[model samples]
Structure formats: structure tokens, C-alpha cells
Target: MKKIAYLLSVMFLFSAFAPAAMAKGVKKEKTELTAEQLVRVGEIESRVAEIKSMDFSEMSKAEKNSVKTELKEMNKEARALNNGVYLSVGAIIVILLIVILLT
Candidate 1:
């Protein structure tokens, strides 16, 4: 009974994580800077640095608020463009737990 339960739980864990870890024996391709995206991200980063270096004391409150909003929008855009694979820390911990339990 315990063996059956363990097998079922392990199978469940594998099924849950299988999709993201599907390329088990496959070679992964490089996922960076292969297009105009690098140039755009570079431009955004440069603009952000320029804004950061500016004297905020010389600016009005409204101007500062606008700059903050612009930075937030740029951050959102960068995140949208950054469609990288995300590994879940919780999932990793759970997988480790399962492995320990199994052994």
C-alpha cells in the first residue's frame, strides 16, 4: 500500500513538472541577443541611465512623477520582451522533498 501511494505521488509530481522539463535529453538553444531586441533593450537601458544621472533637484514635482511613470512603463516593456523560461523555487523545493521521501 505504501509503495503504491509512493509510486502514485511520484508519478503525479513528474506529470506536474513534465511540461517545463520536457527537453530532458535535448540540446537547448541559446536564448539571448539574436535580433533587434538587443538594440532596443540597449536603447532603453541607456535612456534609463541618462535619466538616473539627471539632477532631480532641478526638476519640478510633476516632472519627477512623469519620469517615474516613464521608467515604470519601460520596465513593463522590458519584462514583456523578456519571455525567458522561469524556474519556480517552490517547485524545486517540492521536487527535492519528493526525492528525499522516495529515498
Candidate 2:
């Protein structure tokens, strides 16, 4: 009788989880940017790369500060274009792990 009960409980648990496991396999499509937006992001990235490759020693203090501010703004724009998909995926994984462990 104890063996039957354990088998039934295991079956019930598997039934409860099977759908969620299957659902996790469904891929979420990423949003693609329009051509203009893509071009803007590319421009920002290239400009950032150029700034990174510059010789800081050759610049005046004010120029250095301006470059720093430009870099920050470019980074912010780049992230804004990404729409937090990576963050959402990370949060979903963390939540799924928590749920699995708790169960």
C-alpha cells in the first residue's frame, strides 16, 4: 500500500509540472528594431568605440569631462534600445529555479 501511495504521489507531481515544463520550451521571439533605430544604435556603438580608442592624455580637462558625459549618454541610449529582454529572461530563470526548488 505504501508503494502504491508513493507511486500515485509521484505521478500527481509529474502531471502538475509537465505542462509548465513544456511551456518553457516555447521560444519568445525578440522584437526587431526598424532600420532607422538600428542605424542609430550602430552609430552610437561606433562613436562609443571611437571614444574608447582615443588618447585621454592629449585632451584638456573639459574635453575629457565632455567625452565622459557623451559616453554615458550613448550607453543609456543603447540600453534603452534593447528593451530589457535580457533582464526579463534572467528574472524568469530565477523565478523558475525558485519555484522548482520550493516544490
Which candidate leads the pack in TM-score?
2
Of candidate 1, the 10-residue stretch with the lowest lDDT total is 25-34
Question: What would the per-residue lDDT of candidate 2 be over residues 1-103, giving only the tens digit for each residue?
Answer: 8677656666766786699799897977898999999999889978988987999999999999999999889877888888773547876775575456445
Estimate, for each residue in 1-103, the C-alpha lDDT of model 1 and write its tens digit: 9999799878988798797598677866766765799888999999999998999999999999999999999997888788666568997888788887788
Query: Which lDDT values do the candidates have, in the order given?
Result: 0.86, 0.80
**Alpha-carbon RMSD, each predicted model:** 4.8, 8.2
- Candidate 1 global CA lDDT score: 0.86
For model 1, state the Cα shift of residue 76 in Å. Answer: 0.7
TM-score for each of the candidates: 0.51, 0.53
Winner by lDDT? 1
Q: Pairs clashing in candidate 2? A: none
